[model samples]
Target chain A: MNHFFEDSVFFGVTLSFLSYGLGVLLKKKLKLGILNPLLVSIVITVIVLVVTDMDYEIYYNGAKYISYLLTPATVCLAIPLYEQFEILKKNVAAILAGILSGVLTSLSCILAMVLIFNMNHKQYVSLLPKSITTAIGMGVSEELGGYVAITTAIIIITGVFGNVIGEFVLYIFRIKEPVAKGIALGTASHAIGTAKAMELGEIEGALASLSIILSGIITVGFAPVFAQIH
Target chain B: MKYLRQFGIILFISFLGEIANYAIPLPIPASIYGIIILFLCLELKILPLSSVKETGKFLIEIMPVMFIPAAAGVLNVWGIIKPSVIEYIAVMVISTIAVMAVSGLVTQLVIRLTGHSGHQ
Candidate 1:
């Protein structure tokens, strides 16, 4: 076990890569709707834990090295947004207006529920960053004394549900433009939703990327003010 | 030249994000500061198209890898989450559905208000 402890970081990175690889394999083989890489990585990681009985701390010790990859990965999100600059320029005001309102509305509804339900401060803070992706959500949770675990679950669920049902709602409502359809899912669910948006098409993916960037800014900037109000 | 320009944009946004982390007292972390700065650059056209497109592409390509940290945290709290596994799953499933539904409604409302509903 001590030998395993020394190799935890190596193990963690191996698991991370394996999760990604397995996800790709599963997607190719199964054509499963909800079997996205992130979800797959999560399932695989949990199974590994249960079988090894490695405990969370030891596993984290192994995985912390790979954890640093998140920072660079985050720094890289600017790529797609940069690639889609032309489309964004064509419809700047409309996209901005749509994403902004959408983000604000999300915060309002979540906060309103928090207050109405009388969730304590931690739960409220945890849920505040719920609309964003997991990294930012954790950051938001940490800053506000919210439970990061709870926030992680919220972010994942937000992404999965948005990806699963976003298209149906858009079609039912007859949203034809790829850009509009993309922005709606991205704004609501962040990156996981953005993955689904990308699958829909380039235009939708672009809009979703724009939404991810905009919603992240809007949600982070506006959340504190709203938190103070309550 | 293209890579240089992209790196420059990344560095500039990173700087802005760092500054935000220092300046803002909010509990929310500040990498989002980079996101805000990126938004402003796009809005202002200061970063320029040639500067970041390549870099942005590279970044999103590896987006899924970024979740490693958050998922790792699950390792830390497994004990707490384990005993209450059913409760935790319920919270994850129920709250997720509720939040997504609410967010969709908001996006739809915004689309309608902007008179762009018909455009879609």
Candidate 2:
């Protein structure tokens, strides 16, 4: 099997698509929030690689092509933000305040962990951008001398956690407003959380997407400053 | 043909973003630049929504799948992460919940105080 596909550029890409497609199917059939397609796909891919004794570097060679699409996809997020311009205009103040508060909260929490847990500077900075999307978070982590792989993993876990329990948390906190719910998910969990927000409502999706960009920028500005703490 | 064009536009903007990312001194990523540039183009009507809508939706819909490769990269670093995994989990869970609660509540509070119900 390895010899047959060893030289193919599409090998890893094919595996990713197949696993992700199966994940989507499973989610549709199971109706479980915890059955997140991304999470499922990662598990499946990892299992396949481990079972096949394939080197991660080999898998990433082809898989990197799919990753290449991430920037363009991120650019496309502007469409949703543009489409919901009216609501955005009306709630500009609330939107800014929500995202700002979330960014600050995330930073402060990381700072507190540094103090309480006695975490090293690398670990602290790695966790600093955990709340943002993977693309931006990885950049921030690398810039701050944090482990990029650790940051990516942390970001994914943060997003999956938010996607799974975002609604429950909102309900528990009595957060009934659509804009607020969107802000909560996006600010706290990035695009994956926005996926859940999109399922909730159109306004929610737009607001969530907007928060992702805002929170990400704000985190980039502050991450370096926070890195100086330890 | 339409999707190809739309994808081309997005790719072109992303390339510009990469350039800006190199030119700028900030820590911001190229993707953010791409997002800002594309957004400005839309807001200014230099690029119509129809030009990128379908392809944009397709990209967004598959956004989750894009992270798989990077997320899977985590497997390579388990040795470094294993010792402190508990602390990492602690910080992530606590901070994530705190952020969600604070952001949601603040947005709601601001909306109510600003004399808007939720949406018009």
Best by TM-score: 2
What value does DockQ give for candidate 2?
0.74
| Clash pairs (backbone) in predicted model 2 | none
TM-scores, all models, native as reference: 0.73, 0.92
Instruction: Estimate, for each residue in B9-85, the C-alpha lDDT of model 1 and write its tens digit.
Output: 67667776777778887543445567557756765877665667676666666566556545556555556546545
Q: Each candidate's interface RMSD, rounded to one decimal?
A: 4.3, 1.7
Candidate 1: where are CA atoms >4 Å away? A1-5, A89-97, A108-122, A133-145, A160-176, A220-230, B1-16, B23-30, B35-55, B78-120
Model 1: per-residue Cα lDDT over A28-138, one tens digit each: 999875777677777788787778776666777767766554444455555555556676666665677667767666667666666666666666677777767666677
Q: Output the number of the DockQ-best candidate.
A: 2
**Which ten contiguous residues of candidate 2 chain A have the minimum total lDDT?**
A1-10
lDDT of 2 by residue, A88-204 (tens): 888899999999999999999989987899988889999999999887899899989999989988998899789878988999999999989999999999988987787788788
In candidate 2, position A144 carries an lDDT of 91
Relative to the unseen true structure, what is the C-alpha lDDT of residue A109 in candidate 2, on a scale of 0 to 100? 93
Model 2: CAPRI class = medium
Off by over 4 Å in 2: B117-120
